[model samples]
Target: MQDLTLVMAQLDPLVGDIPGNAERAIETVREARIEHKADIVVLPELFLTGYPPEDLLLRASMEARLEAARQRMADKVARDVMVIVGYPGRRDGGYYNLAGVLYNGDWLGEYAKQVLPNYQVFDERRYFTPGNRPLVIEHRGARLGVLICEDLWEGRPVHQAREAGADILVTLNASPYHQNKPAERLALFAERAREVQRPLVYVNQIGGQDELVFDGGSLVVDAQGELCVRAPHWQVGLMPVGFTHADGHWVPQAGECEPLAEAEDSLYCALVTGLRDYVNKSGFKGVVLGLSGGIDSALSLAIAVDALGPDRVQAVMMPYHYTADISQEDAAEQARMLGVNYEVMPIVSMVEACNETLAESFAGTPQDTTEENLQSRCRGVLLMAISNKKGLMVLTTGNKSEMAVGYATLYGDMVGGYNALKDVYKTWVYRLAKWRNTQDPVIPERVISRPPSAELAANQQDSDSLPHYDTLDAILERYIEDDMSAEAIIAAGFSEEEVYRVVRLVDRSEYKRRQAPVGVRVTSRGFGRDRRYPIVNGWQPGE
Candidate 1:
């Protein structure tokens, strides 16, 4: 057995909670040193004040508090076990997200993240100035180079450290969860390990920060490009590994590599973890959502139950005069099957009051979309009331399809603390609903088969306002995600009429999407920080 142990503390941290996060970091480092007898403990990036602090990074007090907290943590570390952790550091008037090497409770080395990812749910460039150099620290007869997050994604930083005689490349990250992220990270680790001809330790943060969720699927790879130690996904735990000199090369001798999960299952877990963290991290214990007896609510309910357990999820069904009898039955059945708290609060009285106020303005206007919107807004108000009275964070159930085409009510179903599926499309919502049923049939067959309705008007089908989900999602993927022109989409086997309609809807609905709540991102181009379109545009496509 090797004389040294490497411990990866896959810890869950709260954003901007410097003191609490600092305490956790100290306690974990102590555990690794004393209990596991780790020679070095590697923690995730921004471990002291948490990951993607967003605007909170702008505050000057945050930097001071983080430094003070790191010093406090250094006091608890043992002499033999060198600790590598992350914090935001200010040097020469420019702030950088950095990682520090603490040996015998002293500073060994500091590495600043060079590449600040400014795209897709990340705006590091706005708050942080990139660090141009790399850090290699000496400990336990080995020189390990440290990189923070995006530094490993590129070739320069890792290459520079290797040129400086680094025996191993270690990266601290707050990489967000998306479909197939584990495989993607592992593939990168293997390539980088081979590039540097040294073993790699990829330590990533776990927990949710607003719309982004960091899956703790950290791993270690030997120079031979073989995975040795892999941590679990959507979890917070410590995995201890040891390296040995074999054939005059470093190789992991302890811990085991776990097989990666399937794409859909992993996406499901990401949403569950994100929602759970967002709710619990914000100091709320449970969630409340408006159950419209639609695919979005059903999927949201299943995700909620899976994340926080069914006991922590509450569903309220608001039926109106235009609401169908089957919808009421379906929602109740789905709620009962999921073993969640359900309430059927009829919104007839509330709608009546709203209409009485708007009677003068609506006297001559034949009941149109405006009347339908009033009902949706009324439900939003009711849910907000319930959410306020009871300390439950309302999980909005609007899907990406509805959000894209302005098919959703702004102040109605869109009113919530967070949206679990704002990034998921109507088609994916149906697929997830089907997947949920496979675990156990929580949703009724009729609910999935029937046409989607808002229940704001009598027998109002979604098809009246938007195209079929399959066709809509295809066009959306092309125009919004792929960033293709209207003409390019038309060339990709889509009709002139359907393609232009989707493009138009996407362009026109910027106001509605602007008012939408933050959601867990499962797709490559979700509406969170990844996709942003202009609300006021003058360009019109000629398709």
Candidate 2:
């Protein structure tokens, strides 16, 4: 029998903030050492440099800076308890998402990831060269095996670790949140534990990176494929797992944890956590958004205020000539109730000036979507101007529903630094708006009750340009996210014409979405790496 104490620190780390994340990880291990007197504190994947660094890993300076931080963290280790932390590793003419064991300024062992997921929101294949070995370390009179985020998912690492006579298996992850993902992870943990017949400890990072939110639902499983310790979903905390040998089988010690949320709430928390960390971690003083008095903007405002305090959020209403008075009132009222700074910038004059410049070429053309798009473009320019002048990032409020149908104007409503609801559907936009107002009156009922519109043209309800959400979302879910063919979607109670039209729109709009800012992905298939289509393909005309 081997005696060992392990601590799983479920932390939310910001992307690209090496020093800040390193400092917090070091502090967490120190505090946990004092509180639990643990032998080892395991941090989540990429804690030192934040998870899903995306393209940030391409820069050589980032690796140098992070190495400096890791060295600093090693110098501060003045206790018997060691730390197994994750970060990027640069060696052998390539980068690897690596993890290591630290004790008193010494690194005992290291492991690079064997599996680099390239599907869905992952782009690891675009970055690192996959590692090809097993890692097991001797510590505390017992043998310990380690794996990075995607390494544990591969069968080779687990089998090799077991072959190497590992007593306990530990893994670090930066897994993203999807609806019902926690449940699926738990099942995988159980199945994997049975295969290895060792106590498995999994620690995941929590926070939002671009359009992906990592839900920090870390957990521990026993040899019998049973969950002994589970961290609460979306919240950051630490859990202690003690392993005991019972009849040559690994048993786990229990502890308190936060409860995991379900479905919509879980998805919402991921967005909030992602937004909170991205804004706070990016070193921005605050956030600014253009509230259109519509559901998408309203929901985005709610998320921003919830993530970053209301004091840090600024809402501006740039109303155009066609913008109704009710729209202005709704946006203003919501901003006031949320206790955020509100500004009403009348864009009628600004838009008129721009239209005057283009009047000659558009003389014979009847008023159409292009003119309506001008209004949106004008508002986007003003918002961007504010973003630059104040050094504040503009949060775009476009939803997946509009992004799919090309209802949003490029360089207009879509011209912000971040898009909070980019992965959320218009139907969910309404649901989230109602759910948020239930928390308080930050959003007006008028925004929810009225017809969905752009307000760029007279009575320009979204319905006039596309199908109703009740119908459109169903078609999209079946045709897009669910990966159904056009004929298959028609079989799912949607009209053939509706299915064909929606699929056509999605195919044609890939170019626009390609340029759109990354958004939090709550669905299985967002308009991101998850669903890649050819923008120049000519197969859409029913060849």
The deviation in Å at residue 315 for candidate 1 is: 1.5
lDDT (Cα, tens digit) per residue for candidate 1, span 297-340: 88888899988999888999998898888888889999988899
RMSD of each: 1.9, 2.5
lDDT scores in order? 0.84, 0.82
Worst 10 residues of 1 by lDDT: 245-254
Query: Compared with the true structure, what per-residue lDDT tens digits does model 2 show for residues 7-68?
Result: 89988777777988888988898888888788889998878878777788888698789878
TM-score, every prediction:
0.95, 0.92
lDDT of 2 at 222: 81
Model 1 superposed RMSD (Cα): 1.9
Best by the lDDT measure: 1
